[model samples]
Target: MHKEGDEIHIDEQEASGGSKEGVVRWVLAGGLILAVLLMSIVWIIPAMTQGDIEEEATVSGEISSMEGGDSTDSIVGIDGEPGDGGEVTQEDGIEVIEN
Candidate 1:
């Protein structure tokens, strides 16, 4: 019952609605891609490209004397005698002083 012009007009309206829907879908897809790119740049790229901290070196050494002597016989203190007020004792009895 509709005229030819009326049917053509209705088809045009439907086509315009379809085009609008397509534009909305494309815009949403573009927005999702942009969000993913920004997240990668902000959070992932920096962590991947970061550098490590530098370490320091440590040193150690020991002391030695050239004089060949009985280093173990070195006196440290005096032992206390029964009457003469405690006798002077040396560390390990290695008497450095002949008292």
Candidate 2:
């Protein structure tokens, strides 16, 4: 019912029309997603880096061992010699170990 230019303008306006509420909802949704992503990064960064702190807490200047082992070692040339003492004998209610 109008000129070609008028019809085209009317169609363009109709196609481009968007509700204000819809735009607000999209912006809010995007903001919520961004906030969640930022929160995850904040939480994850510290969680990944906490291992170093735990390791530092467990460490000291002198090296400590976790495995069970003897506290003393007999040197090859020192304690390997045979003993000159006679063999010891244990009796009832008594215990003995020969050198």
- What shift in Å separates residue 25 of candidate 1 from its native position after superposition? 0.3
Q: What is the lDDT of residue 78 in candidate 2?
A: 38
**Model 1, 59-95: lDDT tens per residue?**
2111222144555654443444455344654778674
Q: Assess each prediction's global lDDT (C-alpha) against the native.
A: 0.54, 0.58
Instruction: Pick out the ten consecutive residues of candidate 2 with the lowest summed lDDT.
Output: 59-68
What lDDT is obtained when candidate 1 is compared to the true structure?
0.54
Per-residue lDDT, model 1, residue 83, is: 55
For model 2, residues 1-99, the per-residue Cα lDDT tens digits are 235754633454456684444788899999999999999999889766775445455544123432325435423333324564435456886644455
On lDDT, the candidate that comes out on top is 2
Q: Compared to the true structure, candidate 2 yields what TM-score?
A: 0.34
Question: TM-score for each prediction?
Answer: 0.33, 0.34
Candidate 1 TM-score, true structure as reference: 0.33
